[model samples]
Target: MTSTTTTGQERKAPGRPRNAQADEAILDAVLTLMAEGQSAAAVSIESVAAKAGVGKATIYRRWPNKEALLIDAVRSMKGPIPELAGVSARADLIAMVTANRSSRVQEFGKVTACLLPELMKDEQLRQMHHAVMEPRREVMREILRRGIASGELRADLNIELTLLMLSGPSMAQGLFGTETGVPLEEFPVVLVDALLRGAAA
Candidate 1:
């Protein structure tokens, strides 16, 4: 039998549910600032609260600190992990690079670059950063392993070094100026072709 109050009305849960709309608004504010090219140093709880139309205490109740908030925002900003479909390693690599170069990822990279010094000093932030990147690294590692197994890559190739080689040019484009000799969109093809031809058994 269903339980009821002494007055014969149905009883309710103890507390009100958290407002989903408010949560979405707060997260959206953070993303909006990033999209607007606001540096991590420039993002503050007060600014986010004002943009989100919520009190500063509301944000604190949800996130312990600004670093935690940024971690959550950046995690959501990533591109989809590249799928390896037994296609040619070179093709899959190109797909991965293309996905990583999406606008969101580039924006997040800029945010991260702005916060790099703080992230290096803070243990918790460093852990969060590693957690965000681990899956992408594993996917790249798997693709390289598949290439090795298929004899498409050299048997003695160091997967770690190869990952760096594949990604370095694009990363360099971001770190250095965009004038990387080759245009940004052409980087994946050029780097992948060079690696495959040189590294092929």
Candidate 2:
């Protein structure tokens, strides 16, 4: 009765109306299992169904395979990109960084840490992860480009390297412990300021 859209096309499945509650339970079940240190390969459809309290047929009606289900679960957990203020590159970068760190710490931080190592090793899953991440990366790229064009950042700034510089440490802090001792509340300011010191026009 419900339809899902992909790539601008609506896909209607022949079944009863999709249950929103059931969908949430299934995705939450996947995150719970992953957070508990279960590898993607270890999470079977039956196990997910058992944990979600849905019949296997219910899951099958929603997802074609375990990988598809897992990807959807991860996507659900990722949430949307935070709306940028678009006032200044420095402010936008800080906002983006702050939201990312908060999301990692408050959202499914453990689930991500547990999944990344295993997921990155698989070509298909790696590609899927890239697909999910690329949009966010592009946003950052655009912000950096704007900064350079607007004379806020050095024209010679290497956007790719700057992107890594902006994101790498926050990601590391999320995966490992926050060794920087810069409280999460202050990290974005500290990070963006430091980068701007060298990068500012």
Candidate 3:
């Protein structure tokens, strides 16, 4: 008899294939609810189950609680980190920034805007958010490190501060609707170029 196996905090019955369609439906339901302007508190497992057309047991089987489900939904919206070119930091950074702006910005912005207030009040949610974001941040950190090593960026470039500088504007625009008088499609190139002016060696 095949036993269960632990993967991270989740356990899976051996040889039991996950239903990708159900997972997508559940995650998409969460996004839909948030996009429809529901606050995090307003979204419950029951509502998500109804929207997703899956039983509440299905969600419970995957996530221990509503908060865990919400975090996973947000992670799904973030999608995957863009594959870097590894040619130069500038080009790679541009690709990273551009991918963020172009793909999931609107949906992610909606979810984050809806969830931000609750995220601030809940320690667990904040930790979950950080865990989800750290990998992307680490990618940026490595790019900045490589830039320094290759002499492509300033020798004294502060990686942490520079990471904030690179990510802040786009996030600000996404969350707060900050208008920069630049077309959204063009903003990534403009933003990266301007930052590099001061950051490049």
Using TM-score as the measure, the top candidate is: 3
Ranking by TM-score: 3, 2, 1
Error of 1 at 128 (Å): 1.3
Instruction: Give one digit per residue, the lDDT tens place, for model 3 in 41-111.
Output: 98999999999999999888877888877777666655357888899998888877776554556556757
Spell out the clash pairs found in candidate 1.
none
Q: Output the lDDT of residue 184, model 2.
A: 66
Worst 10 residues of 2 by lDDT: 1-10
**What's model 2's overall lDDT?**
0.75
Alpha-carbon RMSD, candidate 1: 10.3
Give the better candidate number (1 or 2) by lDDT. 2
TM values, all candidates:
0.70, 0.76, 0.78
Cα lDDT of model 1 by residue, 88-137, tens digit: 78888888877667665555455545555666688977776676667677
- lDDT score, candidate 2, position 65: 77
Ranking by lDDT: 2, 3, 1
Once fitted onto the true fold, the runs of candidate 3 whose alpha carbons sit more than 4 angstroms away are 1-18, 176-186, 198-201
Poorest stretch of ten by lDDT in candidate 3: 1-10
